[model samples]
Target: MAEEEKTDRIEKRRRQSPKGEERRAEILAAALRRFAEDGYQNAAIGDIARDVGLSLPGLLHHFPTKVDLLLAILAKQDIDSADFIGHFRSDLRSLLKGMVDIFRRNAGMIEVVRAFAILNAESLMKDHPAKTWFLNRTARMQNDIAVTFERAIAEGSIDGGVDAMAMAAELIAMMDGLQMLWLRQPDRFDMVGGLEAYVNRLLTSLGLEH
Candidate 1:
């Protein structure tokens, strides 16, 4: 009887653990949708809680605060992106291709892409909780692209006259602008194709065969 009880208790804990994780994922998904549609400042925690079928206090028990939930969502986005790409390619042509591939993948996940577009723009506010997060993310992306460009330049694959940091900034800006336009009229924008064309032009300017 004692052994049976112990086995049942272990089984119960195993089931409850997955349930807890599933509920947390549900909360994050709901919070992401709310933040995407309303922006962080305008999105209410109560609405998020209701969306996940949890009371405010119950939601708080998981995330503690709205900012905590927002940060968690952002972290999850980073993890998902990293998982999708694995390590970024070091060669200029391959790296550029990877960027287009990422955009193509983003087209399939419109909700996640929309949330990122909305949240990134909203984080520009001085007092936004996610301001630092966006800033750091931008810096990291720029550094990655710049490093790849420098490597290509060193190997004579790209023009040594090209300013790596400047090009990195421009590429990031182009992608962000394209995302905003695409989000506004997704049916009309060929975001992936546009990016691929831009990359081909860049390679041509660098005297590299595509």
Candidate 2:
């Protein structure tokens, strides 16, 4: 009888543990929807909790604070983005093409995109919590693009005289600029097409295959 009771208790715990994880996932999903729709600062934690049928402390039990939830969302995005970028890591042209494809896909999620845009602009403030994150993201992107350029140059795929680091910075600037434009006039502006054209021109200028 003692062994049976222990086995039943263990089974109950196993079942309850998954319920806890499921509740956490539910909170994250609701938080993401709220964040994507309203941006980070404007998204109310109380609202998110209410949307998920939980009270303030209940939501807090899972995510501590709004910043914690935002960080988790960003971390998840980074993981997904890493996977997306991994598919075409072979060459600069391939990576650019892959990026354009990603832009096209992301266009459907305008609210989420807008949320990122707002956070990016707001995080430029000196003391913003996300400032360091944005800065690090920019640096990492620049480095990756520079590495791709260097690889192309080494393989005789591009003009050797061109500065990889400078070109990488320029490319990042163009990408950011185009995204802003797309957000303003999404229907009128063709973000993916614009990127494709710009990349083709860049390759042409570098004497590289597009």
Candidate 3:
């Protein structure tokens, strides 16, 4: 009887572990929806708790504060981005193509994209908790792209005379602008196609194969 009880207790813990994770995921989803529909400052934590059918305290158990929830959501997005861009290829063509594919994938995740767009704008303010996160992300992405461009230049795949950092900045700017435009009028915009065209032009200008 003692051994059986111990086994049962262990089984219960294993089941509860996944349940905890599921509840956390549900809370994050609800929080994401709220943050996307309303700006971060405007989103109420109690409403998010209600969205997941959890009491305020219950929601707090998973995420200690609204900022905690916001940061977790951003961290999850970073993970998702890494997953989307699996196995980074050092080659410029492959890297550029992967970015276009990421944009294509983003088209389907409207909520995630919307939240990102809204929060990115909001985080520009001095007091926003996510300000550093957005800044770091932008710098990191540009640096990654610049490094890839340098690699391509070294391989003679692109002209060494080209300004890698300048090109990276331009690429990121174009991507961010396209995302904003697509969010405004998704029906009228061809986000994926527009990026593809830009990339093709870039490749041609660099004297690289399309």
Off by over 4 Å in 3: 1-10, 83-86
Flag regions of model 2 displaced more than 4 Å: 1-6, 16-19
Measured against the true structure, the TM-scores of the candidates, in listed sequence, are: 0.92, 0.87, 0.92
**Candidate 1 per-residue lDDT over residues 73-168, each given as its tens digit:** 988878876633235555788878888988988999888888888889888888989999899989988888898889898998877999999999
Sorted by lDDT, highest first, which candidate order results?
3, 1, 2
- Residues 1-210 of candidate 2 have per-residue lDDT tens digits of 799999999999999999998887788788878876777778899999999899999899889989998887778778877666567768878887777887888788876677778788879877877788889888887788788888988998877887988987897788778888998998899988998898888767777677
lDDT score at residue 155, model 1, on the 0-100 scale: 94
What C-alpha lDDT do the candidate models reach, one value each?
0.88, 0.83, 0.89
Looking at candidate 3, what is the lDDT of residue 102?
Answer: 85
**Candidate 2: how large is its RMSD?**
2.3
lDDT of 2 at 184: 90
Clashing pairs in 1: none
Clashing pairs in 3: none
